[model samples]
Target: MLTAPIERMLFGLSDDHVIVEPHSGQLMHPEALVAFQRLSADARDAGFDPQVVSGFRNFDRQRTIWNRKARGERPLLDSSGEPLDTGALSDREIVYAILRWSALPGGSRHHWGTDFDVVDRAAMSDNYQPQLTPQEVCDEGIFGPFHCWLDKRIAAGESYGLFRPYAEDRGGIAPERWHLSYAPAARELQDFLTAARLRDLVHKSDLALGETVCEDMDAIFERFVRVPERCYPQENT
Candidate 1:
């Protein structure tokens, strides 16, 4: 039941498809907000305050992050979440490096309003800034116990409809334990989104490495954009 209007929201190009969630002032698909509230309530009962790090991001915001990273204005991290020197890297290599942690504009799931990066506010110091890296979720990391709690929730079928798209690294996008995609809506978008459509969108945008991204659109879609069918809530249930 994807409408022409709804499809517009899939590529981070439209603002009409989402509304502001009052509690967090985060823009999201209405259905996702409801489900997220349920998940948050449950997590709070367990002493975890589910704070959203990123919600719905538009193409412009994504592009700024990409272009900045490409110009060395922002830090680019490797697969291990360590900083890499990109001064001598080619534009194509820089594009791939950025994709390891950031999604290309119009290809990102954050555009869909059904996915977001989150952290447990209960574990953060007053001034703590979440890096959303694997190191932060390691056994000894500050957010380790929070992610462990999330693991248990997802495993016990208690995380509402939330699931990790990059739960396991399959050599595509690096694993992100902090990113949660709402299965009901996100699954539909994932299925309906075609590489051809994405190519058209990327070609229209002003990306940092526009030429390189256009040439490698299919590979990007298959590796960075497409998550396996195994990453759904039922698997957890």
Candidate 2:
């Protein structure tokens, strides 16, 4: 099933799924952008200026992020959300740790151009640093109102075809309250990207911790790649 077209589209190697848009200042799937704009307008009308901080990310971009985190060039956090000493962990452990927070190259939802990290730009100070932490979206935090508003509007979002991919803390990835996906397009890709396909790709890819990551393909796939539908946002709706 990992044919050339599948490989290209899944890895973000081709531009078939995305288009350049001035409003996003990045590439996005045309349908997704339209839905996002509607969501943005609705948020604005509700008194929040929501913006997409991250849109489409190709495999190479994700590789850079993975590699940096693996090599300790970037911060690696533990499951408890505390910083970890990557230098002390084995390469295999490093791989698992990275997967807790990031997808492997060619395995990220952002590759689909239908997933994005959104935030309320109006809520932050000009110099506010974005940590995307759980605290930041909690009831007392700065973006708390934004996430609360989103929670109420999520049901209404079905009309626009958008939903959160990580609305809850599933066993695999941490809960990313900011990550939204256009269900209409992303759901197809999700069904197509099975663990077997991901395992084959991981073995062949020059991923940062490829050897260790592939050594336990079944567990890795179950935990990171082959996420169940219950983990998606529609469950909340």
Candidate 2: Cα lDDT at 200: 77
Identify the runs in model 1 with alpha carbons over 4 angstroms from their true place: 1-4, 235-237
lDDT of 1 by residue, 8-52 (tens): 788777978788877678888787788788888988888888887
Using lDDT, give the best candidate's number: 1
TM-score of 1: 0.91
Clash totals for all models, in order?
Answer: 0, 0
Candidate 2, residue 168: Cα displacement in angstroms equals 1.3
Off by over 4 Å in 2: 156-159, 232-237
- lDDT of all predictions: 0.83, 0.80
Best by TM-score: 1
Q: lDDT per residue, candidate 2, 50-169, as tens digits?
A: 878788998888888998887789998899989998768988888888888998787788898988888888899999877788888887888989888888777654437777777766
Error of 1 at 56 (Å): 0.4
